[model samples]
Target: MIHANRWYAAATAAEISTQPTEHVICGRPLVLYRAASSGKLVALENRCPHRQAPLSMGTVVGDDIMCIYHGWVMNGAGQCVHVPHQDSVAPSVRVDAYPAVQKWGLVWLWIGDADKVDETLIPDMPWTEDANQSSVFIRFHVGANYQLMADNLLDVSHSDFLHASTFGSHAGRKAETEHVKAELDAWSEDGAVYGLRTLRDVVLSPMAAAWAGTDKPVTRTHKTCWTPPNNINIELIMENDENKVTIHHDHLMTPENETSCHYFLIWTRDFSVHSGYPTDEDVRREQSTVIGTEDISMVEAQQRNKIQFGDPADIPGAADKIVVAVHKRIAELQNEDQGLSAT
Candidate 1:
């Protein structure tokens, strides 16, 4: 749903430790740095119009970000207030300043029409503040439609067959998907499409039972949800008789181009220190390497087919309900956007 705002993930908390870092998201250049004295954060255009030298090339002053070329310094507002080579009284030269909000340990940038972005509409994610739960992030670039990646992330049933040995259920129980609900945001940007798809299934695994110290064919029901413009959550209940849920998240496509998508995803699992995995990062890497490869294959194949087959213009089947919903939402949002653009 970020399509509606100027919203872009500028940088991570770790990357901005003290020095300024240049980041590019959705093709928009950004510079992020923390204030030396007060630890305040700032995000602005990476390019300094004066010489087009990247502001990120500059180091952080007390609270200002100073350019390395000729020592032109700008404050949090991105206004050039001091030119070391020039008189200290030089008139302020302001660069394009992006409205940045620091939340969820990531700096969010508003890159669209500055006057229209509404920060209030930012999506709410509950896990963003779950400090007790540690996490690891895995990022990737997909050579397909952003929507295609979102659709794949939202589909969990494919795991059974596609990821037979890699973090997927081999039990092959009598599983089924039931549509829970779908929603579209009314207040996001021009052509922002947002929705959710839920698939419910029961896990009946003999292997899991043996590993979990439980009876054979231990069965448990779980809920999986797919939310877009950018989110997919799969909640799996392990045999804790305790409904242990692991959430896998997806950030919908930030289009790298007309035909490619730059995507980010992370799967969250309760840290199991004694599961033979010393750190959550290892578990994350294992899962991502396996399942992520599987998805990349399918997504890339789909793209290839489209190029050779010429869109086919029609897809038929029940396996495509979520895809249908995605297309519908995209059309709706696009139509609304066209009108706004004309106005």
Candidate 2:
């Protein structure tokens, strides 16, 4: 089983309401809703214990949820507060309640032991909270393993080939010797692995030029960090003589199951907010075309190949250094979760 102690970004805070929202995290079905009276977000097992009906199908009344099948009321604590036909409520009649909180405009849920929930594990993205930065949020349901998505994000080499039409430039599409010359740096810290690639004085694609507000030769840096069980933050910086632009990406992947995932994406930039040069809709459309079509298509194809061929012994190259680190960290976390390690 995946480590439950880690928090997952289940849904946007605005998505939750008195009407229950159903989501699957780490292969477990969960129901999320806000209390009618208190407006506090609550998460509980989707099932109603009495008849095995989905609690999400019930109505929210004050701080409790009343089952539609029969008027059985369950509170935010997962305790059955009222049974229409009975005078006494059994203390044992309760469902599993997971700890949940609203942070960074998202509803985060902890799926493991309630007592071990760590609030610090949630990603800290001050840019998302910054009023000066204009941000765009998008969510994707990917028909692929979450690991594959994480690996794809950590490895920037694929962008040259896969994203050629959208963001790739001649500097990125070069011989292996040129690729080897790109400075590569990687490290691990605080349960995360970071990788940075610096490309010096490279030609910029049209979109990249527009985003950076420069068509001249530029120094580009691609930095990505992956935090287990599944979250990645990417920073792309393009610098020319007159202008420097930085784009921040927040990628959150929550496993819907072993073979599928929920991908939450956010793109923020400081330069374009007030300039009115590239509108949010324009950027969103470009990203949707590149990510929704190109990126997702490639990853899903890779996933299909993996499923058809099963796990194969593959050779790791210099570009795969960060990928190797990610796999090692995930294995370590899984081992720890299984009580195989003290650290």
Give the candidate number with the greatest TM-score. Answer: 2
Q: What lDDT score belongs to each candidate, Candidate 1 first?
A: 0.58, 0.82
> Per-residue alpha-carbon lDDT of model 1 for 278-308, expressed as tens digits?
3676656665676467888798898889889
The true-versus-predicted C-alpha distance at residue 241 of model 1, in Å, is 6.5
**Error at 10, model 2, angstroms:** 0.5
Native-vs-model 2 lDDT?
0.82
Scored by lDDT, the top model is: 2
* lDDT score at residue 289, model 1, on the 0-100 scale: 73
Superposed by TM-score, candidate 1 places the C-alpha of residue 198 at a distance from the truth, in angstroms, of 8.3
Which residues of candidate 1, in runs, are more than 4 Å off? 88-92, 115-117, 143-145, 170-228, 238-245, 248-253, 259-262, 270-279, 300-316, 337-343
Per-prediction TM-score to the true structure, in the order listed:
0.73, 0.93
Candidate 1 clashes between residue pairs 3 or more apart in a chain or in different chains: 1-229, 4-189, 6-111
